[model samples]
Target: MLEPLGVDATCELVYREMLTHPGEGVAALAQRLGLSREDVGIALDQLSSLALVRQSYEPSGRQRPVSPEVAMRILLERQSAELEAHQHRLALSRAAATQLIAEASEAMADPQQVGVELLVGIDRIREWLSQLATEIQGEVLTFAPDGAQTQDNMDASRPLNLGLLQRGVRLRTIYLESIRSDAPTLDHVRSLIRSGAEVRTAPLLPTRMIIADRRLAMLPVDDHDSGRGAVVFSESPTVQALHALFESVWERARVVGGAPPSSKDADLAPQDAAALKLLAEGHTVESIAKRLGVSPRTARRITTSLQDRLGARGRFEAGVKAVRRGWLPMRD
Candidate 1:
C-alpha cells in the first residue's frame, strides 16, 4: 500500500516508527529504526509531501503520523482525478487520430486511379472498411452469401454497423433464405433491423459484397477463398454494375420479419416456413444445411418432416403441395 503511494521502504519504516511513538523527533525515529539521521530526514520530507506525516504544533521539529484513513483518501481521490484526466486525453487523441487518417486517405486517393485498389490482407481490408465506413455519406448496400453470417462475423461487424447507423446512415443487407432458420444469425439481424437497418433474404445471392454510397464497392478476390484478400472498386462502371446486380437481387428477395399472409404459412413456425421456401427454390440438402448452419442430416430430417406434413410422396411433390396449400411462396 505504501509502495503505491510512492512511499519508499525507508519512509515506510520511519512512518511506522512514528505511528508507534507519536510526536517523535527526527533523530529519535532515526535511532529507533536503525536508519541514519539524514536518511530519516529525507523520509520525513517525502512523507510530509504525501500528507502522511506533519510537524507537531507543540514541538516544531517533532513529527506526527497523520491518520492512515485521511491520508489514503486523499491519495485515492487524487489518483482517480488523474485517471479521469487521462481518459479525457485519450478521447481527444482518438478524435485527432481519426481526423489525421481521414486527411491521409484523401491525400493518398487519386481521382484517376479511384476505380480499383487491391487490398492485400485481412487486416488491411478491415482497416479500409473502417475508413470507408467513417467516410460514407449515403446508403450502404450489402449482399451476404450462404454460410457467411456466423456469430463471429456478426460480432466483428456490430461495431462498424452500429457506428454507421448511429450517424444516420441507411443500411440494407441481403442474406440467403436459409438464414431464416439460424437462431443466432436471425437474432443479430433482428437487432440490426430494430436499429433501422433494412434486411431481406433470397434463396441465393450472386456473391458477397458491400457497396457504399454508390461510389465504392468491395468483394472478395476469390469467392471460394476469402483469405486471398479483396478488391475495392471505386470506378463508375464496376460500381454501377454491382449496384444493379444488388438491386435485381433486392427486388426478388423477401423482406425479413414480414408477416406471412396465408393461413397455412401463419400456422407453421417461421423456420419451418423458411425451409419450405428453400425447398421450393430447389436448393440441395447440403446447400440448405450450410445456409441454415446445421448438419446435412438435420436438413434432410427437416425436408422429410415437411414432406410428411404435406402428405407428399417426394421432395418435389412436397414443394408443389406446399405451394398449392399456400405454405410456400411461389418464385417470381
Candidate 2:
C-alpha cells in the first residue's frame, strides 16, 4: 500500500538489509536490498542526511552505516490523517452517485422520459450530464456561466461532449467574454467546435447550465463551489420553463464569428472617437499627429478630449470605454 511512511516495496527491502548488515559496507547492503550499488548508496546517503545513519571509513573503504530499525522506520512510516480525509471524500462521492442512481432521478419508469432529477453534489451533477450526453438522441444545450477550468471539470465533461458530438448530436455552448484569454480552455473548446459543437459567447453571464433534449435540465445550486453546490434535473414544468429561458438567451447569442463588428473606424466619430480609435492601434502622440495630419499640440488636445468624454484619466481608459461603447468591435 502507498503510505506516508512510503511504499511497501522499499520498506521491506530496507528492513531486511538493516538486519542482515547492521554495520556492513554499502555494497553488501545493496545486495541484501537487491538493488544496484548506486541505489543503495543513494538511499543510505539519504538516511545519513536525516541523521539516521552515521558515516565512517574503514582502512580503505568509505561508506555510511545504519541500524536495521532506522531503515525500517523510514520505509514504514505511517500515512497521516490527511489521507484518511481523502478516503472520506471518496466515500462521500460514491454515496452521492449511488443515492441518485438508486432513486433513478425519476427516470427509471422511462429512462428516456422528460423529467426532473435533483442532484445535490457536483459529482452527481457531472455524472448526470455524462449520462445524458450518452443517451441524448437529439440536442444538448450548454450555458457555462462560470469558467469551469479544472481537472474535475474536464474529467466529467470532455468525453461526454466528444461522444455526443461524434454521434451527430447537435451541441450548443455559450461562454462568457472572460473565457477567451484562457489558452488551455480555448484549446479544449476549439477541439469541441472542430468535432461539431457550435459555440458562442457574450460579455457577462450567471450560473452554469445544461439542458438535455429540452426535457431534462441541470443548473448549479450555487456558484462558489462546483462540488458543494446542487444540480436540478427535472421534467417538471417549472424546470422546463426555466430551461426555455436559458435557451432563449442562448439563441440570441452570436455564434462564433456570426458577426464580428468592424475594428476601430475613422468614420465613426467626433474627435474623441477618432482619437481613441488611433490610440487602440498603439499610436503615440507623434504617431497620432502624423496619422491625422495634425500638430503635436492638436494630437494632445484630441487625447484630452477623448479621456474627458469617457470620464477616464488616461488614453488606455478612453480606449476601453470606446470599445465598451461599441466604437470598436469585440472578439473572443
Candidate 3:
C-alpha cells in the first residue's frame, strides 16, 4: 500500500474513478472504494504525472467546476490517438490480405471454366476450398443436401469462411429439409446468417457440392461412403455438367423457407417419421437408420411391417412401391 502505487492496478483504479465521478471528495471516494485516504492520494499523484488529472484547492464547503473544455479536449485527444492506431492496423490488414489473395490466385496455376481434380482426404478438400475461398471474389454457390458440417469441421472451416467473407465474396447455400430437424445444425445456420451468409433449404437431397465463382467446384464421385477415399475438385466439362445438373435438380426440388419447422422440431423424435419417410423413399433399414439420425436396429424395428403395409416383395420393392403411392410426401 505504501510502495510507489503500482503502475498497473492503481492507474486503472484512478482512471475509473475519475471517469465515474470527477466530483467525489477524498474521504467520500475512499469510503466508496474501500481504500485508505493515503492510497487515493498516491493514485491521484501517479495519474497527475501522466497529465491525465488536475487538482486544485477550493473553499472548505465549495467545489471546483469540471470545465467542459478540459474534459472534452482530453477525451478528444485520447480518441484521436486511438483512431490513428486503428488506421495503421487497418492499412496493415489490407496489405496482408492483398498479398494472401495474390498467393492463393497463383497457387491455382490456371483458372478456367469447369476444372476438377481428385482430392483424397477431408484435409485435401479443405485446403482446396480454403485457397479457392481466398481467391474467389464473386459468389459461392453451395448445394449441401446432407448438411455436412460437424463441430470439428466448422472449427476447421472458420478461417476459410472468414477469408472468403473478408475478400467480399457472397455466399448462397442450400441445405436439406432434414437439416431443420437438427438443433445443432439450426444453431450453425443461425451463426452462418449472422456472418453474412445467405442460406436456403430444400426437401430431399443427395450429398453435397459447391460451385465457386463458376470456375472451380467440389463434387463427390461416390455418395454412399461419404468418408471414402476421395472427392473430386473439378474445373472440367463433366464437372460443369454436374454443376448444371445440380442446378436443374435444385430447381425441381422443394425450396423450404420460413415456417418449415420450429425449435420444437429437433426435439420431436423424428426417428419414426423419418423411418416411414425413408422407407417410402426406397431406402433399406440400414440406409434409413443413417439418414434419419438413428441406429440400424431401431430403423429395422420401426420399419418391420413396412413391406407388409405396402404389399411389396421385399424392402427395395416396398420402398419403390411406397414412393409411387405418394408416401414420400408425408414428412411430418
On TM-score, the leading prediction is 1
Tens digits of per-residue lDDT, candidate 1, 161-239, equal 9999999999999987767777888899999999999999875566779999998989876555667677788857979
Estimate the lDDT of model 1: 0.76
Q: By the lDDT metric, which is better: model 1 or model 2?
A: 1
lDDT of 2 at 322: 60
Segments of candidate 2 deviating more than 4 angstroms = 1-116, 262-309, 312-332
Cα lDDT, all candidates? 0.76, 0.61, 0.59
Q: Cα lDDT for residue 284, model 3?
A: 65
Model 3 over residues 1-332: C-alpha lDDT tens digits? 21111234765565566568766766776777888989877767765654556654645532232344664445445434544465466568867976874564344434452343556566676777767766787988777655445788667766777677677788777776556657777788777777887777654455567777776666554454445423445556756776786677656443344443446554323334456665544456777766644457756776876656767655544444444455543122
Off by over 4 Å in 1: 1-114, 261-284, 291-294, 302-332
Candidate 2 C-alpha error for residue 332, in Å: 33
lDDT of 2 at 183: 70
Candidate 3, position 287, lDDT: 74
Could you give candidate 2's per-residue lDDT for residues 16-58 as a string of tens digits?
Answer: 4665556677677777667887877666655555444565566
Report model 3's TM-score to 2 decimal places: 0.49
